[model samples]
Target: MNALRAACLALALVFCCTPPAWGEGFALNEWSARGVALANGLVGRADDVSTLAYNAAGITRLPGTHVMGGLAFIAPSGSVETRRADGTRSTAAKPNTWTAPHAYISHQLNDTVWLGMGVFSRFGLGNSYSGNWPGRYNMYDVGVQTISFVPTLALKLNEMFSVSAGLDIMHGHMYLGTKIPTVAAGTFRRFDNDMQLEGDGWGVGAHLGLHMRLNEQWSVGLSYKSQVTMHLTGDVKFDWHGDNLARRQAHLPEARDCDAEATLQLPDSLALGVAFKPLDNLSFEAGATWTRWSTYNALNIYMKDYDAISNKEWRDGWNFNASVEYRPLDWWALRAGFFYETPVVNEDYADFIVPTNGRKTLSLGMGFTWNNWALDLAYAHVWVNSTDYGSTGASGIRNIGITGGRSKNVSADICMFSLSYAF
Candidate 1:
C-alpha cells in the first residue's frame, strides 16, 4: 500500500479503546460538534477543517487564515449505590465534573494543500471518595486523565476531490488512590496503599479524509483514524502508616520488569458525513461514526513475569449521532441533533468505577457571527438505562456481597461555547 494508506491503518489500531466508559472527551466534540454550523450540519462530512480531531483534509475548506477554540462543561445527574451481601447499603464515591478544552488553526498553503494544528484530550475521568466513604472496602476513590495533540495536512487532488492526513502526539497518566483494610488478632487495621501508577509515553497515529463536491449544492465527506499503543513506565512504593501494629504487611503487585511498565489500548473509528445546501442561506447535515470497542476485552496488570489482573472484563459497544444547521441571516445560525450509544462494559465484565450503559440523548445549539468573529452555543441531555450484571466478589461478612442489579435513569448535561476568528 501507499504511505498514506499505511499511516491510516496504523493510526486506526491505536484508537481501539479511546472513549472512556465513565466520562472522557466532552460530549459536543467527540459526539456531534464538527466545524461551524455549516460543518456540524453535515455530520463532519467536510473533514477538511473541523479542528484537528476530525479529517485533516477539512482544513482545505476553511478560509486561508482562520483559528478556532472552545471549552465544555459536563455534569452527570445520578449516583451509584451499592448493597453488600450483609444488607449494608452504601453510595458509590463520585465527584461528577468534566472540564474539556480544544483549539485549532487552519491555513491554506497555495491552492493544492492546507495545514492545521490542534490540541485536545481523547479520554479522562476523575472520581474521588473520602477515606470514610461507604463502600470503602471494595472501591473508595480514583482519578484518571489522558490527552492528545496533532498537526495535520490536507491536499486538494483537484476541484472535485481532496485528501488530508495528520500525526498525533499523545501523553497522560493514571493513578489509583484508596485504602484497604488489614485484619489482625481480633482487631481491624486501616492502612493506606499510597500506590501511585504514573508515566509519560509517546506514540504515532494518523487520520485520513476524502471530500467530494457533486454539482453545485451537494457534497460528501469520509474519514478514518488509526489506534495507538503507549508504554507507561513509572515507580511503585508501598509503606504502612498505622498505629499499634502487631506486624507489618504488604499486598503489592509486582511491576513486570524495571520498577514499572504498562501498555494501554486505544481504538480506531470511521466516519461518513454528507452536507447539503438547497438554498444559499440554509444548510443541513447527517453522518455516521463507528468505533472498534470489541478490542478492549481486558487490562492485565503485572510485574516482571508475575500476573496481576486482566482488564478484559471491559466491553464497549457501538454509537450513533446526527445533526442540522440553519442560517436565517448573514450572522445568525440555529442547530440541533440526536444521539444513541450502546453499552461499553458487557454484562459479564461491569464495575462501579466505570459505570456505562445504553443511552439516548437530545441536543440543541445556535451560532452568531459579527464581522471577523463568530460564537456557537449548544446543550444536550442524555438518558441512560441501568446495566445488567453478576457478582464480582464477596463484600462484607460474605453475606454482604454485591447483588440484585436495578435499572437506573442516569442523566447528563453539556454546555459548549466556541470563539472563531477569520483572517
Candidate 2:
C-alpha cells in the first residue's frame, strides 16, 4: 500500500471505528435482511442462490445462472435523563426514528468468479428530545445520521473454497440540535433553547471474507469490514424556539459558520459462521460477530467559530451476537438468534439523546425460493435488560446538577423485508 492508502487507513481507524451514538455496545448490524434474520448465519457458507450478501464467498456458489439484489427498512430509538441535587427527576422524550432504505446486487461470472455491489447505511441513527423536556435546562438536544456504498468481488478457488472482499465508499451527514445552558443573577431562566448545527464529509475504506467446505455436511467462514471517515460541512445556526421567533432569536450565538466538521467513531467488525446438515433434509447453521469500539473514548466536537466539548466513554464496550437456522426443504428456510452487548458509556457520559447501554436481542426470519425469484422477511425484538448508574464523572455535564435526573432505560425493536431475484 502507498502513503495515501496508509494515511487513509489510519484515519479510518481513528474516525470510522467510533460506534454509533446509540446501540448495544455500538455494533453495526446493517449487513443484510437475510443476515438480520438468520442473525448472520452465512459466515463461511453459501445458499447456492440469492442472499449472498451475508457471505461474499457464497456468491461464488451461485448454482448455475447469477445475479442478486434486494432492500430493507430500519428504525432506531433512544432517550436520556437527569437527576437534580434536590432528589428531583427529569427525563427527555426519546425520538421516534425513521431511516432511509437500502439495497444490494451481486453476480456470478462463472464457476470460480463472482462480483457484487451494495448501497446501504452502515450507520444512520438520530436521537431527538422534546423542547420543553424536563432536563431542558441541564440537557436539551442531540441528533446524527450516516450512510455508505460498498462494492465487492469473490473468487471460487475450487469445489470446496472461495473468498470475497469489499470497498466501503462512505458518505455521511451529522446534525446537532442542543441547548447550551448558562445562568446569571442567581436565576436560571437564561437556560433557553439553542439551535441545530449540520455538517458533512467523505471517506474510503475496505473489507475481506474467506470460506471453506470441510465436508458435505460441514462448512465455516470468516469476514471483516474496514471502517471509513467522512469530512462534513454545513451552516451553523441558533434558532430560538422561544415564543417570539425574532425578539427571542438574536440572543443566540452568532457564528461565522465557514468551514467546520463533526468527527464520528465508525467501528469495524469481524464475524464467524458455520453451517451443517445433521439430518438428510435438515440444514442447520450458526454465527458469531464482534465490533471494534475502543476507538471511541470520547465525543469531541470542533466548531469553526466556537469552543469544542470533550465527552468521555463514547467508545467503551463489546457486542456479542449468535444465531441459528434450519432449512427443511429446498424451497424454505427458518431462523432465530440472540445478542448481548456491553455498555458503551459509563454513568457519567450517559444522556437522554443517547440512552444506549448493554442490551439483549431476539430475532426470527425465513425465506422462500422459487427458481429465479424469492422473497425473504425477518422480525427482531431487542430488550436491553435495564440498568442504573451512579455519578462516575465520565460525563462532562449530567453530574453536579442542582435539580435533575440520574437514571436511564434503553430498548429497541427491528423489523425488515426483502424481495430478490437471480438469473
Candidate 3:
C-alpha cells in the first residue's frame, strides 16, 4: 500500500537524519517528598508508605493500613552551542515545566506478612528549541514519559530482617519533531518540511528488596530493579511544502502519515543504603545507586519497507547520596540531603538530546504529623555540569557533521509535597 511505503520512508528518514536519544538521561528518583528531601537516602529508613518504592521490605515497620500520594514540580533550563568555520551560534531551549506524581498503599496481613502497591513515573524528558535552530535536523522538540505500577509482598523473618519482591509494569510514550531540508534534493530551496513521530509502548520487569535491623543503632537496605524492553508502534506524519512535480523531481516521497515501530531497552539499577540513629529524635543515612546503562548501546526502528539504526555506546552510571533527619518534637521533623551523579554518555557519541556531563543536587524539607495524618514538603536545586560535544565527530540528521561545540548554563529546580494517612 502507498501508506505502508510512506511509513517506511519516514522511519528510514528518522535514523538517517538524527540521533535516536528519545529516552536517554531522564531517569527520575523523586518518588516522594520525603524521598527527595533525603536525596533518595531513605532505603534504610523507609518507614512510610513510600517504602513501596525504596524498599518494600521496610513496610514491615508499619503496623496498620497506610496510604500516601504526592506530586513533584520540575523546571529545567539550558542552551546548546554549535561551532563552524564561519562563527559560533547558540540556541536556548524553550522554557518548560513538568510534573511527576506518585501514589502508594500498604497493608499488614497478620503479624509477619505485608502487601503493598504503588504507581509512579520513573523516566521522563521534555525539551524544545526553535524551528530554525542549527540542530533542528537533529532534534527541535521532544518529549518522553513513562509510568510504572508495582505490587509487592513482604515477609518479616523474625525480628532482625525482612525480604520483598514485586512485579513492575511500565508504560512509556514518546513524541519528537524535526525539520527535513529540501535543499538535499536540489529541486526545492526550502528547509521547512516538518516531520513528527509519536508512539507509546508497555514493558514488564521485576524488583527485589532486603531490609535488616542490626541491633538498634544501625539498619541496612538493598534493592534491585530489572531491565525492561519496550516495543513502540506509532505513526509518522510529514508536512511537505514543495509541489508534487518538484518533489518527484527531487526523489522525495509524497507527504503522508505512516506506521512505524521501534524497540527500546531500559536499564536496570541496584541501590544500597545504611542508616544510623544515635538517638530517638535523630538519624543519618548514606546510599548509592548503580545503573547499567550499557544495555542501551543501540536503537533500531522498523517500517514495512525500511529500517534504521543508531549507536549510542553509553556507559554505566552511579548516584551517591547522604542525608540527615532530626525530630525536635514528636510531631515535627526536619530533613536535609545531598547527592552526586556520574555521567553515562560517552562524549564520542554525545548529541544535542542530552547535553550535560553529570549532576549535583541539594535539598531541604520538613514534615508534620498530627493524629493519623501526615504532611511532607521538600525543595531541591540541581546543577548540571557543562559538557562539550560534536568535537568527537558527531553527526546530525542527514549526515550533517558537527566538528565542535558545547552546552552551557544547564540547571533545574524541583518542589514536592506528599500527604499520608493511616487507618
lDDT of every model, 2 decimals: 0.56, 0.57, 0.80
Clashes of 3: 2
Give lDDT: candidate 2, residue 77.
48
For every candidate, C-alpha RMSD to the true structure in Å = 7.9, 6.8, 3.3
Local accuracy of candidate 2 as per-residue lDDT tens digits, 1-423: 132122222222223223343355434464555766766565755664333445667777665454444444445544444555655554545656544455666776777777777666666555555766654432344444556677888888988888888787887766555444433223334654354456567778886878888888898878777756555555545443335534333333221122344566566777777877666555557666666666655544444334344455554455556666667788888877766667665555444334555676777898788987877778776665433435444222443353334444455566776676766
- TM-score of each model, paired residue for residue: 0.82, 0.80, 0.92
Residue-level lDDT tens digits of model 1 in 215-327: 56787778787776766655443334333332332222211112445566666767677777788776666776676666666544334544433344444445566666677
* Per-residue C-alpha lDDT of model 3 across residues 1-423, encoded as one tens digit per residue: 353354344433333223212112568887999999999987999788998999889999999899999999888888988876678888898988888899999999989999999898878777789998888866788877788999999999979899999999999888878766544355455555688878888999998999999978899999999998877888777776346655544634445566788787888999999999999999999999999988888777777666666677778889999999999999999999999988877777666777568888999999999999999999998888877875454445225654577888988889999999999
lDDT of 2 at 206: 83
Off by over 4 Å in 1: 1-48, 88-95, 185-200, 235-239, 242-247, 250-259, 309-316, 391-400, 404-407
What TM-score quantifies how close candidate 1 is to the native fold?
A: 0.82
- As for TM-score, the candidate ahead, 2 or 3, is 3
Highest TM-score model number: 3
Residue range with the least summed lDDT across 10 consecutive positions in model 1: 7-16
Error in Å for residue 312 of model 3:
0.9
